[model samples]
Target: MKVKVKVVLKDGILDPQGKAVLHAINDLKFKGVGDVRIGKYIELTFDSLDQSLVENETKEICQKLLANPVIENFDYEIEELT
Candidate 1:
């Protein structure tokens, strides 16, 4: 099984890194770029074929290890491969 986790800042949270990137984009002559938020993606592979179990475990991993859950939100998807 393969799990992909995405962690992103919650709405209304300040993202300095995203702001800097946005400024750089405008400086590079890119227009119409609005608010941008940065996030993280993590991929994990396992031998199990259970999608439900993998999703549950992946959520746990995000809550315990991957994401802070304070100012950030996380979601995950599980893929079973033969």
Candidate 2:
């Protein structure tokens, strides 16, 4: 099984890194760039092929360490690999 996790800052939260990325893009003459929100992407390999169990564990991992529930939110997808 494989799980993909994406962690991003919640709405109304200030993201200096995202802002910096936007500014840099504009400075480089890239036009029409809208609000940029930076996030973290993580991949995990699991021994079980059970989708439900893997998703549950992934959520737990995110809540405990991968993300800050107070200021950040996360979503994950689980896939079984043969």
Best model per TM-score: 2
Candidate 2 local lDDT, 10-68, one digit each (tens): 99999999999999999999899988999999999999877788888898999999999
Residue pairs in collision within model 2: none
List of clashing residue pairs for candidate 1: none
Q: Which 10 successive residues of model 2 have the least lDDT summed?
A: 73-82
Please give, for residues 1-82, the per-residue lDDT of candidate 1 as tens digits.
Answer: 8888899999999999999999999999988999789999999997877777777788888999899988999988777776
Model 1, runs deviating above 4 Å: none
Winning candidate number (lDDT): 2
Per candidate, the number of residue pairs that clash is 0, 0
